[model samples]
Target: MAINKLPIKKLVEFRRLSKGRQQTFANRLKVTKEANSGGGDYWVRSISTISNAFRVNDNALIKAKLEEVSNLYNAEQRSQTKKMYKRNIDILTKYQNFDFSEWWPSTSLNFLPKPQSILEMHGLPIQIRPQQIFSYGAENNQSVGGIWLITWLQGYKDEDLGIYSEALFRYLSSYYSEDYIINPAACMVVDISKMKVIGYDKVIDGEIPSLLDASIAKIKAHLN
Candidate 1:
């Protein structure tokens, strides 16, 4: 359903399977609002990976070929084949119209606005701000990475509000894939308003075993 995030090292090798076409798509992917013609290895790899992983058939290749056949000068000679191919391609093309390459990393800066909105919607403090975020180590490094935030909510008074932690995790997990956030390298929760360290956690293996509860607990403990 989604293109999951791979480690920088793994993503590099994966993209190489397309002989650097992944980079080309990556370049076009960020700014482009929609899928277009003229794809490369990245596009092929994404379709292949999703098809195999999800046990679904990807007919984009077939559809493109069928369209080419339909446009041939002697298409009337192979009218039966053309009709059948057109029927199938048209049905499959709807699902295939979307590009999977866009999922490899997020393409929208809208993710930045969600935390504050969700927090406000839940009546939590509005002072939350991102301290550090993760990246895929590219030229722009636009992928959503780990998040560290400084918040004004007094941990001692609001430590029981699991909603705060849940809101952050939910927003990130929803926009980005669960694979993108399986583990964050470092997450620091600080209280600069009081000039203190609320809590800090780093995962060598990048695993968030307990999700938000783990981070919330660590930071709350510091407040105690």
Candidate 2:
């Protein structure tokens, strides 16, 4: 099949196939089906169907194939063909990381929002600023990308207790920035009832931060 000729419907058909069949098609298309830890196939399939419904037919796999195609054939001819589908291909590629699960908030959570709400339920307030265009070192000196509905916690004014601040800082820093970034210094958790602040230095200001060492364990400990 011509690399540039695969339509959106074809991808929809491929996406609907069983994992084994999808793997076979992936081999044929010369596209790497990157594996996610859980439900990767479902995500890929769902997104492909959504894109197809919108009549998007830009083939990212084809562009990579074109690079290979160029090595063997006339470069000028292939470049002209690429221009025809470049827009669709560019858009589809940009949405490759789309997560439907995260895009829609849980109705069950009463629209409380994820991560932040999750933290709140556990008696921690995640302070996220109003949505801004640029999050990382952009318009302002703020370092957070703030892509998630909730990004950084609020500044420590009323919550200026030392232990909480230190614990929050450690937790924020340990997180990956692939999706969003959080400020380590500015921490404003809304709920502090569960957190038993024993003393500074021992828990918060010591050489090792308890939040960092047992972030999950601490949460579970609190529940018990």
Candidate 3:
């Protein structure tokens, strides 16, 4: 049987937990997978709302989209799903006026790129999936593309953000070619709740890769 793929965020958290908690977390990962046969759409509408605002340069769309999602959630039959949707909407409502200027200076962004292929971690079962990819600058700018990995998780320290940024950059380097015009400096993690933009500006200097590999190895052992 194929091994279940663990999200990068879980892998990051796994390394920080106590040994006992690690096992509990690994078990929870398994239980979560078995409980939900398909991927969750908890943040789909919210993310689409934000992405659409950037794509169309209309901040008003954020409020409008949230209203649409809120109505749908109210009518949802599944309690768990409805709660997830409501939570996402509540978070978005707080930052519906989110300042895109913090991430990009351009007034308008180019068309949203097609989703990138899933990033496999060097023969490991772990995968890294970026939430959004966009390009901005002069209409014909060559170095306009950027990768933004959105995380709603709160209380992440700067150290954690650095690790995420480095991991994302490594994955982007492996998967995308020059044709994509991906700006290494533009690669970042968007901490929505914190309203902060973080990038791998200060390279952790050869430590992050080893740290990630070790974490993945431990996670793999737990999976077995």
Candidate 4:
């Protein structure tokens, strides 16, 4: 591997390339159009608002900084959710503070990939930028009775669900699960009937479902 420094030309070239792949910017454009909120580059300001800026190319620099941002975001969300979960627990157990840390994200909600190519969804505290992960795997970690919760993160603005759903289902049939016997080259089974688990594509064309859905489903499957 070699480290290539970006010259003026390279920078310009890279900027064009990146701007084309500017997912966040495209999203901002959509939201502004949809909400009609007198848009004034809120997302731009948010990115610029980072305290200590680091170079884009350095992996260590990017990871550390992004993780720091994510930690703060994920922790806050978990705490808020914990408060609610605590209330629920109290309602059930008569105000006993049962530990809600069970799933209340020690880290933050971010997509982390392991050595085995099994991407694990973690407690996402901060915003996960593009460089943080490549592709998504299953949703969150609580796999009960050999079933997994898979979520497709939004790809583009409008049909983000379709992008992820299509990609993830393909992954299931081609690599991980191999639901049915499709052509080796065109190697994904399009239908769910042949799937091993009682899998789904319900929210494939929408926002991601919480990992708890998988957990609850596991419990329900056991009860049945």
Number of the top-ranking candidate, with TM-score as the measure = 3
Q: Which stretches of candidate 3 lie over 4 Å from their true place?
A: 1-4, 24-40, 70-86, 105-116, 135-141, 152-155, 180-182, 202-211, 221-224
Kindly list the per-residue Cα lDDT of model 1 for residues 1-224, writing each as its tens digit: 01112111222222233535554544443345322322222223223333332222234554554465346524555666555445434433443454533222343222333333222222222223243334353343334433332222222222312223333444455555533442232232322223222222222233222334343332223223
Candidate 1 at residue 2, lDDT?
A: 12
Q: Model 2: runs farther than 4 Å from truth?
A: 1-116, 119-136, 139-142, 145-163, 166-176, 179-181, 188-224
User: If ranked by lDDT, best first, what sequence of candidates would result?
Assistant: 3, 1, 2, 4
Question: In model 1, which regions exceed 4 Å deviation?
Answer: 1-116, 119-134, 138-143, 146-166, 178-182, 185-187, 194-224
Cα lDDT tens digits, model 4, 13-41, are: 22233534544433443344321212222
**Roughly what TM-score does model 1 have, to 2 decimal places?**
0.25
Q: How large an RMSD does model 2 have? A: 20.8
Could you tell which candidate, 1 or 2, scores higher by lDDT?
A: 1
The candidate, 3 or 4, that scores higher on TM-score is 3
* TM-score, cand. 3 vs. native: 0.70
Name the 10 consecutive residues with the lowest summed lDDT in model 3. 33-42
Local distance difference test scores for all models: 0.33, 0.32, 0.62, 0.26
Off by over 4 Å in 4: 1-158, 176-179, 182-224
lDDT of candidate 2 over 1-224, digit per residue (tens):
11223221232344346757755654554342221122223223323333332222234443444344334334435664544334233433443443423321221111112233112213332222211112234333334311111101221222233334444443344342443445533232221122122222343445434443233233223223
Model 3, C-alpha of 67: deviation from truth (Å) = 2.3
Q: How many backbone clashes does candidate 3 have?
A: 0
TM-score of each: 0.25, 0.21, 0.70, 0.20
In candidate 1 the C-alpha lDDT for residue 172 amounts to 52
Candidate 1: lDDT of 199?
22
